[model samples]
Target: MKNYPQAARILVAIDCIIFGFDGKEIKLLLIKRNFEPEKGKWSLMGGFVNEDEDLSDGAARILYNLTGLKNIYVEQLETFGKARRDPGERTVSVVFSALIKIDAHDSEAVRSHNASWIALDARPKLIFDHEEMVARAIEHLKYNAALHPIGFELLPERFTIPQLQKLYEAIYNIPIDRRNFSRKLLSTGLLIDTGDKNNNGATKKATLYKLDTEKYKANFHSFWNFMPDSMKE
Candidate 1:
């Protein structure tokens, strides 16, 4: 192999912006760094890309290590190559967007890593360019949620129509018409009536439904247009 002139060695890192939605609100998974230039401060879960591992595999490993969960929805959002982004070193980070069922993660693993689920509006000031990454993730989420059924990643296997509506409302931060929303959702044929009701409610219980896995998987890429014209932007 012919040797070329010396090239600058820079680090490549992976940062994940994990979003979770409960029946009420959307949340973010953040870690309080225990060691480094920004110790004891909140930041996105991340690590350096190992020399021997593929980028996607490295991201999955890091995510599993932090959340103790697998098979979660993950997508490569964008790459941040700003030279001065990381104060500890010259690093280019590939930011990833992830969504997981909030109640499914192992609490012990999250505690071990000093990570917590923070409300989107109440999140602490993050270190480095993490804030920018999160903003972009939210923008991407709103854009995608309007067109695809990606919001299902944050819900449980069985949920009520109201619960599903709440999740979408949380994502777009807007109110939805119950009659129209329910009618539109049922028209998709992607929901299966589970023959169960949410008995936990004090008032009248709402019927429960589950995703028709075959249909959801088959039509995931199709445009949903679930939101109104005013909210589509």
Candidate 2:
């Protein structure tokens, strides 16, 4: 076996910033660092990419290992390649942001890894460049959720308009006008009346609706300012 004489050793890694909505606030799935260099501290779920695995496959493997959910909204956000980013090695990392429904993931898997869903705003200082990665992912979410309906990935299949509004408000950190949000959302023709209602122990029962799959696919990338003017206030 022959190797390049002057080539330096470098390791590839994947870091996934998992986001979820528990119907009230948006949160991030982070793990307690289990190995030293920074053991026992909070960190993003990450792992070294296997020699034979592609980058995307490595990311999916890491996500599945932590959440036990697949085919969700996963997007590659950026790459961090600072020479000494990893105190232990010369590693370059690819960052991914995943949006998952909080109730759908495997809690046992989450616990096995010492992971917790901490509120996005309340997450503690992360180990390394991960804090920057999450901040970038947050901006990415705001930018895309305003133009697309990807936020639905953080919601249940059947939800009320108010539930949807809460998801957006969590994402944008803004209070949306009830009538305005409902009017804008309904006019898009993306939701289908399921003829079911959820009161959730409330005095008023709200109608449950699901996405019109066809319309959702058609408009997934189309621009619609779901971010209303109320956000400016």
lDDT of 2 by residue, 170-207 (tens): 89887888899999899889999999888683314899
Clashing pairs in 1: none
| Clash count, predicted structure 1 | 0
Clashing pairs in model 2, backbone N/Cα/C closer than 3 A: none
lDDT of 1 by residue, 1-233 (tens): 13745767789999999999867889999999999899999999999999899989988998899888887899999999999999999999999999999889988999999999999999999999999999999999998988888877899898888888888889888888888888888998989898878887532388888888898889999988877545645
In candidate 2, position 18 carries an lDDT of: 96
TM-score of 2: 0.95
For all candidates in order, the CA lDDT equals 0.89, 0.89
